[model samples]
Target: MSTKFNTFILTALASSSSFGLTPAASALPPVTAISGYSFTRSGMDLNYVAIEFDAAVLPFEVQAFVSKLGGCLAVPENGTDNFNAAISLVLIDTGAPEDNAAWLGIVHTPAGDGELHWSTIEGDSVYFLAFDKGGSSNSPEAPLGVALDAHSQQWFDVTLDDGSSNIRRAVLSFPASMLDCDADMIPDALVLALGLGEDQDGDGRLDWCAPAGDFNGDGIIGAADLSIMLANWGLGGETDLDADGTTGASDLAMLLAGWQQ
Candidate 1:
């Protein structure tokens, strides 16, 4: 199916209108960086990386994204313990302007044995699969194989050559895409939170590094100043604040705190 069709199906599965369960504004959980991993030489081995998230209700689009990347559950022979593999994330839809579903990006080393995976449906659980040896050259005695489930998220392990082993573990948090704030989701908020633009507040100021809206300096946000931020919003132009994917209350609050004292 086309990316658009896949997104539509995911949206239908999640019941698009039921966004009430998510807070209009909330704090993102501390993101644990994917570690103990490195990219491969040809940039194809998935190894060492791990990703975990809340699976209570999976987002359809996110699930399709993971499925498109192609997941595998690797199993090794008796002696080896570390199993390694990698999946590529090259396809992205980047939905419409007003639609929050289009924002998608992959954040992991693409070449090594470290890999991350998730589903689009909410309420489901997050799964993990890792490998230790994934180079192009394989010994005739290598005992590594993987199994993948397209429907349900399950745990699987891959064995390596040295009699060592690894197990896939599930996580307990929602993916960035599932977060709903000011009509946008986590991806947008993350972009803003990262300070990627010069005019984060969209107030026409080119230098957003000053305290144009950050009131407390603690970095936590409030709504009073954000009330002044609804004027300008979009891409490429100046008036886009908060970078939370749109020019709305959430972005406003982020800029309001940075507003000049």
Candidate 2:
């Protein structure tokens, strides 16, 4: 929603709920270095998780209502009521503000303490989810209990947990459908698609994707891959290894880093 970081921090201190330090139900899956992507924006270098996969690859929360099928939400912990009502999970798609989807961590507001609350981000609007237990009384005045299936949580700790930032991170479970940020049939689980190409269609699958540096798709990153990276130097097509629209020193560094991988 809004990038009001300063106001958010102040409100969080005075808000009804604070689940930032709540322990996760379980440990999360480990993310290998090559399994995710990292980029810098607004002076922040976020190394978040992104990949493509099948519906069965990871366990997902299911519900009769399509809205709750495969998404993520944060709630209160046992005996504690205070929770962060708004958590914006930002997805970096196409490296553009409009293209990225906000999904986690980024909070806009806190409803209150101990009360379970949720939010949904459509095109550009933010709405809270309200339930009425199959009746016609679903409204903010009469909120219903939301079903949250926690397959696992608290899988990893933030190396950034130095108290400078008042937030912690965990790999929460979600329906594989959420991974399909573009709403395409293909799940964007291309863990190795880092800097592979534009992925112009934003269809969750990579374009001209090979192993991180496997240009020729020979299943290995070797001399052939190096040749390809150099051949297309200063270009912006398939060999744009960094996906920043250019193939140059950084791209060469990327290719060389993966030599014989």
Candidate 3:
């Protein structure tokens, strides 16, 4: 699709749309910190992060996926429309050694407002279709939609394009509700693992017990275990095995080879 930049900025409104929030054009959402993962680029160019929303999040409007090449796109406080036919999602290039390409896909609901959107990092070429509700005949566009199986997780591959020397970084964002929690009940071991209470193991034993406090899977909870836990400290995908957010020696020793005893 030909690249055309539009300057029309709309005010934020709490419309019936599920995507939510429309930040002022001048402002964007803060860069999200994705724990346990790192993004690096070989060249001096920039990388990008894209987000896809679940249809349940915005039940009233036609669902569309948006990509922000280098950063995040802020949803305006007021609702915004993606089918306006004038505005296109913005693309940012970090100037890495490799070219930047990405994909955004939206799945429509059979009868409800629950659609699913996904994004993949592509190189230099991306396409999307503009669809209107009520299923009317529309212009056949090259970027409208591609043949895909929504049921498969392997629909796209993340790799460098052939003959391209540029390398870029990418990130993904989804609503918190998308995650399925552990049976709606936080496990005690997980809780203690996350550092939420004095009960180190949830096994009714004090942390001083040889078997209870050894978190690093090591045979003992000594200074070595403490060092390991301190190395992986943080939340959102790190080794919060106990489900608490902090990392301490207790968590470290749990990694010891035979600490379970």
Candidate 4:
């Protein structure tokens, strides 16, 4: 995800009540780096990711963050990992840099967590940095080791200095099923469709990044898409472009703004 959004986008978001989350203030920090591991549950292979935001985000921040995504899901002990096309974020893969993906695999987070229907990405820098001290008492990875196992794949693995207090540390765990759109038995991919759907058509490649507000998946925001949104007005689902859980004035405004006409 981008460290920062452009002036116009940020300003517009600031004015809109589209997210419909609490506190009506910014809470979550920008994700700067990450790390990860793998696990199993009821025959399902899950992906786990350790997150390091630019700041020490609080618990409430997690809830607020999901509100931005249009809907929130509960995945018992796993946090909410599914990401729709509500917004953009950073994606990283521990096993393969090329496996780096977008969307939220960050399910139920005690602090940092989600399932991946799909999410969006505005920026990326996929790399692995490991500073494994192997049980050394003074290692920086010690505090963050739970999410960074010895045999796991990861993004960053270096010395966490006084500059790294880890108050910003959290984890993202998700089932491979949520992200294996490519059927590769792994969690990864990128969403170039900044203002569109998540993996539409399921061809992977995020449907090669669908056009803005192409709700019907016909590759454009046309009369049919607008009609669908209007039909669902005051409701939720894809028509709720702003992802506030209900199609209302904000969703209408966004749809109109992105209208192909």
List the candidates' TM-scores in order.
0.22, 0.29, 0.21, 0.32
- RMSD in Å for candidate 2, one decimal? 17.5
**Candidate 2 off by > 4 Å:** 1-124, 127-136, 142-211, 219-223, 234-245
lDDT of 1 by residue, 1-261 (tens): 011100011211111111222213222222222111222323232222223221211222223323222321222111111212111111111232211111111112122444433222332223433222332222233432222211122223222334342212211112222222222211222223323224555543334243444333444344544443443444311224443445555655556555445
Off by over 4 Å in 1: 1-163, 166-246
Q: Which structure among the candidates has the greatest lDDT?
A: 4
lDDT: worst 10-residue window of model 1 = 1-10
- What lDDT score is found at residue 110 in candidate 1? 23
Q: Return the candidate ranking by TM-score, descending.
A: 4, 2, 1, 3
**Candidate 1 C-alpha error for residue 117, in Å:** 18
Candidate 1, lDDT over the whole model: 0.27
Q: Model 2, 153-207: lDDT tens per residue? A: 1111112222232222222222222233222222244221222224664433355
Model 4 lowest lDDT segment of ten:
5-14
lDDT of 3 by residue, 104-220 (tens): 222222223332232212222223433233332222221121111112211122211122312112222222211112211112222222232245445433343345334454656
Better of 1 and 4 by lDDT: 4
List residue ranges in candidate 4 displaced over 4 A.
Answer: 1-146, 150-208
